[model samples]
Target: MLDQLCHILLLVVVSILYHVTFFLPPSWVSVLRISVLLLCAAKPVSVMFTELFGRFRPMPGEGTEGAGKVIGYLERLILVILMVVGEYGVIGWIIAAKTFARSRQLADSQAFCEYFLVGTLLSILSSISLYLVLYRW
Candidate 1:
């Protein structure tokens, strides 16, 4: 409970700082924006899952939690990059690939399906939201 609160607080602080990057030098803006985006996609999203679904335990033959975290980080980063480059159509392919990869597990367990769906949606939404906030502000 307390840990979740801390994560939420940290996310809020980073979001506030994200806005401040606009005041920085133009050369630093891109780097800082990417850095902040990655930061938001990482721990905060994991914390969000924890809060929403409780602890996630992968079924047998599934990858470890750390691997899932890394994958989520990479997934969100890639989505953000795609958005920045205005490749919105490609986003569907990425989501489709992910869903296909997890198809067996998603079909096997109801809980896993819900977790994957919510996590994927949250990740995608967060990436889009972050991009809009940073670039459109």
Candidate 2:
């Protein structure tokens, strides 16, 4: 719990720093913005995801706790980077790959399917939205 709080605080600091460093070069600004936005979105977006999909709960031994959060963070990081670089095709591949990677878990439970789908979709949507708003390039 404390670790999570620290992680959140760090992200918030980075976000503030990203906004304040407008005098920096555009490339540095973009990278900082991406880092802050992705980190900042990870927890809140996930909380919203759980609230929005409250009907579906994870099954026992179905998924790891922090693992999902870390995976989501990395996923969004990659997605935002890809978006910035305009590799739209690879983004589709990433989604497909994630889906395939979790095929067994997704296939095992209907609730898990809904949970995974909604979470993945929310992650993608949030990444795109953040990129549209924060990214200068």
TM-score of each: 0.74, 0.72
lDDT string for model 1 (1-137, tens) is: 79779877877876686679778898787787777777776777767766776666446465665676677888998898888789999999999998998899889898788878877998988889888987897
Candidate 2 segments whose C-alpha is farther than 4 A from its true place: 1-28, 50-55
lDDT of 2: 0.79
Encode model 2's per-residue lDDT on 1-137: one tens digit a residue. Answer: 78669877886787678677877888887688766676657666766666777567675574566677678878888888898788978999999999999899889888778878888998999988888877654
Number of clashes in model 2?
A: 0
> What's the distance in Å from true for residue 18, model 2?
7.8
lDDT, candidates in the order shown: 0.79, 0.79
Query: Whose TM-score is greatest here?
Result: 1
List the pairs of residues colliding in candidate 1. Answer: none
> In terms of lDDT, which candidate is strongest?
1
